[model samples]
Target: MHETRTIADLALEVRSKNAGPFWVTMELFMRDAVGYTIVADPAYLNASTVARLYGIDADTVQIFRLPALHVVKISFPRPVSQGSLRDRDIHAGQHHVPLALFPLPSP
Candidate 1:
């Protein structure tokens, strides 16, 4: 039987942080090129999937693929302004959890 793998399992690091007062940035530093390709594939982690995961519009998600570095960077507008009364994560530090825990598509 094949073992299931998640983003966190294939990545060297998965992190999220505030890009600014209105934006959040998340990065996936894959362990190698293979992991990078898997994470960078639109079939696996496209704007649509990111939208569903973060409750944001697909058009608002910007994905940057750095195959040379085995990194994937994603940025999106925050639902609420940083430090606003409605905001929960001021730093957006824990926002990567959902993506990190997301299961990779079966090969």
Candidate 2:
């Protein structure tokens, strides 16, 4: 296994929100470019890895890296529509717990 650190160790804030009725997005904001670079690597933060964390198909996930802002954003299809009677998360905010638990490679 790779040497790793929690996102909490590098990100200034980690948040999740609803993109729409069908999607949830997670945002990881790092304090600076050095921290951002460490977590921004595709090897550690990508669709397939995130899909595994959320127990979803890789095709349903998308990742964006914003070097200028030192942030990483990820969007994925939700199994249920937002605010649907069957939905477990309404704001889509709490879904970021899984992302927080994912380990980033150590620099």
Candidate 3:
């Protein structure tokens, strides 16, 4: 299901309301979007937000940049190293891409 609040609104609301850390709204946008996009910014999201939203450690969510519409290089900054994120970038149009986070590999 879709979220009621827009991404901009949600971000602003989060800072303003300090709405507990668990309530994060995952956002989807056109791939062509430029400049500090949510997808890029969230690469360095704080730990508290991850716990509040996905019930997972922010550190566990490996973020990476992808080339094709189907894959990416996942980098784990801790014990393990990197992996590939597959099929998740399958967006409808060619103009936009997706930034996805998945679990880090076990050491």
Q: Pick by lDDT: which candidate is best?
A: 1
Question: Candidate 2 local accuracy as lDDT?
Answer: 0.87
Kindly report which residue pairs in candidate 2 clash with one another.
none
Q: How do the residues 5-45 of candidate 3 rate in per-residue lDDT, one tens digit apiece?
A: 23333222111111122222233322333322433444443
Q: Which ranges in model 2 have alpha carbons more than 4 Å from their true place?
A: 1-4
Per TM-score, the best of the predicted structures is 1
lDDT of each: 0.96, 0.87, 0.30
Weakest 10 consecutive residues of candidate 2 by summed lDDT:
98-107
Candidate 1 local lDDT, 1-107, one digit each (tens): 88888999999999999999999999999999999988999888999999999999999999999999999999999999999999999999999999999998887
The clash tally of candidate 2 reads 0
| TM match of model 1 to true structure | 0.95
TM-score of 2: 0.90
What C-alpha RMSD separates each model from the true structure? 1.2, 2.6, 15.1
How far residue 62's Cα lies from its native spot in candidate 1, in Å, is 0.2
- CA deviation > 4 Å runs, candidate 3: 1-29, 43-48, 67-107
List the candidates' TM-scores in order: 0.95, 0.90, 0.28
